[model samples]
Target: MVSLSGSWLANGGGIWMLAAFYGATAAYGIHVGDRSSEVVESTRDVGDAAANFAGFKISTVNLSGQNHVSPGEILATAGVKPTSSLPFLDAEAARMRLEEMAWIKRATVQKFYPDRLDIQVVERQGYALWQKDGKINVIARDGTVIAPYSDDPRYVKLPIVVGEGAEAHVVEIVEALDLVPGVRDQVRAAIRVADRRWTLKLRNGIDVRLPETGLDGALASLAVFDRDKSLLSRDITVVDLRLADRVTVRLSDAAYEARQADLKARAKAKKGSNT
Candidate 1:
């Protein structure tokens, strides 16, 4: 029961007093139902209108912790209508609705008594870019797809994973790559082949084929080869590490011909020296 003071009674006049009384009674009878939703909605609109006329309308909004999502999106998701009054706004319900958005990790909605609404949102971070079926998306750290790729400058430098099921197991490969920065730094994309093993595409167009088993050891060996023999800098097309026994490197066509010519020249020199 809302007990109005003498001063409020004097200021509200007869029409405002009657509306406020009816609104208060309607508020008390509010309930959730599919059949009576229209009735409830009308009553809510009436109550909020009356309360708004009494200067309880939500006129100001304070929003924070939002970087990627726009303020309008949050307000719309929260169902903050133009005629919504502080007393009628369901803060907890609004918060749950806000969190349904992909970017919003969590959200808090608060209504101040007179005329203010406050919203705080913790947004999810874009961890990597995932490409599949000719579409690219920004994915969260846990591999949840946040949104379709828009070439957003913020996520341009993120590591890329390609294939159908790569998003689900991206964390494992990403963590393994992190352990070997020497190879990781040069990786352009981690392509999931047959949804089984990963083939890393380097920035220089070199494909590093990793074994289905012993992934870490293969990457470590590749790093050592790069460090000692400057293998990565050489004119190589593919570095096949699928076989545990050896690292098979396929040289570029030009490099292969150059190597063959050098071997022949050495052989001819030896034959001439014998003469």
Candidate 2:
């Protein structure tokens, strides 16, 4: 042991030694940088095993929020297999893949640690069939085209609309038809023409040509005429409701000739009876 304190040289030497100790302590750091690198390399090996699907299990798969798509189909789309490893699973990538499907509007994917995957889906709502280039396809209310020619039978009764801008105008046509009593039942299909006018093909094979303006009024008038005079029952081929005050009916050639002859004969008979 050294002599007691209060000696100038001893005090000066002790201060220098303390300063050297603090400097060494400051230089030393608690770092796992090398250890982290080794751990990452190990995880990489595990990821390779997972990619090869070796010694892994999918304990739980929770699927929800699906309406049109099945869980199996979703799994197939995600490219996920039961034996796939946790390190190799990409939940976000799987979600993106599932969202690409036609019926899937949105999707969410979550991973619960230790071996569970949770999948959620939002499905698109199909509204009408859009007829384009002579082929009919289903569409959403916002005019997004869904599947083509799906014989799903659930959409069998949905109204089919045709022509340019038909997808945008189909809703309006349906609404207008609602205003006319029995019109919806009688209408087989509605074709929106180039001039923005509509030609309704009736179930009886008759065509009701509506005017560009006042279409609802014309439809209502035709409905009333159909009910009272059985206009639809006649053998007329087309009913042109373009005129404001009067309806111009274009009957079949034979029916027109027969009507004219009957009218003339009735007039002659009435004149003779009065005389």
Best by lDDT: 1
lDDT of 1 by residue, 128-223 (tens): 999999999999987888899886789899899999789988987898899889889999999999988999999999999999889988888998
Candidate 2 residues 1-275, lDDT tens each?
11112211221334445454334333221122344656544544444333323322345678888767777788879756644444345678788999889888889988765456678888887777888798998877766777786778878877878888888877777778988758788888888888388898898888988888987788889889988998988899998998889998888999989999999999999999999
Residue 170, model 2: lDDT of 77
Residue 131 in model 1: shift from native, Å?
1.9
Winning candidate number (TM-score) = 1
Q: Which stretches of candidate 1 lie over 4 Å from their true place?
A: 1-30, 34-37, 53-55, 257-275
Candidate 1 residue-pair clash tally? 0
Model 2 local distance difference test score: 0.72
264 in model 1: Cα distance from truth in Å? Answer: 6.0
Superposed Cα deviation of residue 258, candidate 2 (Å)? 1.2
TM-scores, one per candidate: 0.79, 0.65
